[model samples]
Target: MRLKILLIAISLAAAVPASAQTSRFSPALLDRPDVKRALQSVDERATAIVDEWIHLVEIPAPSKKEQARAAYIRAEMQKLGLTDIRVDDMSNVSGVRKGSGGGPAVVFAAHMDTVFPEGTPIKVSREGDILRAPGVGDDTSNLMAVLEMFRALNRANIQTNGDLIFLASVQEELGLLGAKHWLETSGYKPDMFIAVDVGADDVWYGALRITQFKFFYTSPGAHTMESRGGPSPAKAVARGINALYNIPLPPIADGLGSFKLPVVNVGMLGGGTVFNAVPREAWFTVDLRSLDTPTQDRLTAAVTAAARNAANEEGVGFRVETQMGIDYTKAQPKQQRLDHPLVQTALAVANHFRKPGTPLIAPADVGSTDANIAVSMGIPAVAIGAVRERLPHRLEENADASSIVPGIKALISLAVALTTR
Candidate 1:
């Protein structure tokens, strides 16, 4: 009779569509005694959180060179009494807050690397609510917020049924390499993944199809006097760039604020020893993105063809190298991903704690985050932000210093709600 009952329960669960299983998150969870204490702790330590944010931003954490920041995060993880702390070869730091069992494991990830190079100035400047610095808002603010979230949980002795893993990833700006490595190599497999790397007002549930390429044009050398008549890699580069831009793009996808989709951009260009000679080689990088695979493939072909055509027309040799390539064959279906409880639960929790008077938050079907790695692996994941950051990857990047208090509280609530459920 027990065996029959177990079979019946399994059959019943399988009968329900994934979309019907809604998120278990509730605003009422915030009122629980332990949760209330955690929120209060954030309020009490708001000043220190901002101060640490400033200090962390100042640390030079350029991609593939995040040792300093990784050490700091590992030390903080130890201070929080988190177990199984590990700093991987790629400088990805992870620690586990063990739970009481009977719930899903959730990973909260924030990248540590910034786009700025090592020598870039990152001294944070504060003006009332705004804090400006090179790496201040991008992932640094979110990294600090996640740390505080862990601290607040410990402060209240909040325990859930499932484990919570905090991951401070590196090389995110170089194409989510650290996350991809950790998820593939780490022995643990999480039931849900949350990348805390966007602005507080934004929630992204879909992974954008992104492909980056570096196209090189090469030609035999020529002196300044003979350069005009000889094949020039520089001229081929100029032509290739102009032709790539001429490729007709599909209409931009809607609901992505200020981000035009199905777009191609030349982000980097250079290659010459001196200006007087016809360069032997010139190269430029193309960052192409689209909302879906078909569009991305079509554009990728067009971009490469345009580059090759330029090389042929200019009588210059050409080659292409892929800088970042994502394989989406293992990704979940669109509706299945959108309907998953992880995304819905995050939406509910984020909206509940969102700043008043802001527009209702909606999950955008777009992402260029470490969560993209999880999405491609068919894991349930969503990307959300901890603060209202702006101008990411620019020298003037800034975020609202006052917004972090609520942000930490929101993270606390989300972690408790998801893991306890």
Candidate 2:
């Protein structure tokens, strides 16, 4: 009976037309007078938009320290005349553009935090169409773009059937904390969620399983001469890291660009306070990711066991703490999520505005953005980019200065498309 059910499901999936799934978004929507005016507004304010983007990028918004950016976004939200504007305790800023009612409520989110520290220089440099800075492209560019998209909607007095909520999420770089807090506690429950936090050419419809662990090894401190044959936390840390890497990883999933999946990386390590002594404690962090839950669970168990085993072998005390563990129990099935209008509409609208001669935008099944929180909650969500950016989370990060013009226009169209339908 289970085989029969599986066969029937496969046949039903095969019978559905691709066009039927993406029919909610039509290019004709872009031809409407209001949308046309909104698109034109982006072109007219192109220079100002880029300037604002650069200025926002220059503001340091390290994770959990986004007050400056939050203030700016809140003020801008007020300027847009949005209703129910709020700055949550976690620094997440959100406002609503109320629609005529009876249509789905949508939330468009873009993170305001970057991976760089507070003292890092964030001044943006421009050489023709390229803009370079520490946080230029990752989500600063998208934050600027989403702000402009809202401004353009107001410029044309465009109204839709459903309300649009603009969310400037904080601490997204710290494992989507701000978004998770807001989504869980906020009184509003949106029907669809869109995270404008990737490149304009890509769309992500699924959330990857991500777990972060910080393991510590402890022992009594000792002088260098006395440390001989004694259990050393530093040595235990080394052995544990080695064992973690030696643990077998599942085969890498395909189609994720430049990312090797089912992988474990030891991202940070620190130990001794002095060179002449064995430290009392040493610790390392592990970031593990996979495309599926079973693989993620298996690897997570292996990682913990390896750390404990190393501590045992080295005769040191060991304890592990989870830094980030996202629950996916309420997540929708794969086929149901893929067939949702939220994902299909985003794909259609994104590809419609993609640069000419570029390959068609395809939706990937991986996500590392704030949308992951929404996906885990069974909310219809998709993550799409707002600019062509490179070298994210690096000092050399940069984006095309001119790509944002069309990117904003695309955002305008997406907002209108999703809300009106």
Candidate 3:
């Protein structure tokens, strides 16, 4: 089945039929003189975007706390004179670029939240040409990238047969809630969803296809001292852990992209009290993830079965719960390969600076971002980063200022290329 996007409740200059205002360049994008000029123009206007990027990065938008950042993006969209700017109830911020011809709605998005906590010091520091801060590259760069891309598209007067929607979305850090919300319920139907995140340059271009999970095990707790033979919810949890460890993991030779077996991190647990008493409640969160759905499904079943068996054998009540996960595996609107016109265009624009290669596409990064959500929804999505990496997610995270312009140039060029059609 094909996936569609929804865009709701916004004052449009005028509603143009989707067919009349949209265009889709299949096979590949045809390079035009305007595209070349726009790329050059983007390079020339790097400073303004870079300054703006740093400013936005300075605001901490952690997970559900994305209101401030969403407002920031909305203001930028409004400032750019974008029409029909709206911030949804879920806090997804979007702006539309009106088109003159029939064109599909191509979504352009950047995540609003970071993994850092609220009030984390977002103060950017300049050491030589490097820009340092907690959320500098993870997504702060992307937030500014989306806004600047719109600016360049406007400045170049590059009009496409498609309506380009710019989104500053929230809750990406938590199961891609914001992107999922837009994909599931919006007034605008999108033909494609382009997500800009983590500017890793060209060291890598592909994003991971992952299925995140939260497995829980529950059983009536028994006195550790009196019920030594029966199943202690904790023990069944242990068996679940063992089952997760033994769960069949995808082989490295699968060629279907790298995979991570259920990480099986026991996030939290509850049961029992002090003074030698048998507790009646126990629960724990299990994290499972992989590139393939079957792999994740099999693993989930194995853990459940293990928990169930242990509970039955020990004579106690047991159940499993799914905290959350992507509904599907691959990012939606498939055909998001590196050779896709969009990816290729992004590559061309990035060439003025760097090339994403193997290390950046390392097996470790498995769609742990908003890009994952888009991919699952059948949208063509890719995540990128700027200024390189070191100390990301740490108190010492940083990016080079000299490299910032190049990164900005890359985003502008890619945006211009994608929208030029």
Candidate whose TM-score is highest: 2
What is the TM-score of each predicted model, taking all chains together?
A: 0.95, 0.96, 0.75
lDDT of 2 by residue, 88-191 (tens): 98999999999999789999999999999989989899999999999899899999999999999999999899999999999999999999999998898999
Question: Model 3, stretches more than 4 Å misplaced?
Answer: 1-51, 102-104, 119-122, 202-231, 253-280, 310-316, 329-339, 355-368, 390-396
* lDDT for position 134 in model 3: 86
**Off by more than 4 A, model 2:** 1-16
* Superposition error at 221 for model 1 (Å): 1.1
TM-score of 1: 0.95
- Residues 172-270 of candidate 3 have per-residue lDDT tens digits of 877678988877777777765666665444322334433333333445555557766655666655665565566555554343232334344565566
Put down candidate 1 lDDT per residue, 1-421, tens digits, no spaces. Answer: 9999999999999898443477667777888999999999899988989999999999999999999999999999999999999999888999999999999999999999999988998899999999999989889999999999999999999999999999999999999999999999998899989999999988899899999999999988789998767788998999999999899999888999888998999999999899788889999999999988889999999999999999999999999998778888899988888888888888887888799999889888999999999999989999999899899999988999999999888888889888895
Better of 2 and 3 by lDDT: 2
Instruction: Give, for candidate 1, the lowest lDDT window spanning 10 residues.
Output: 17-26
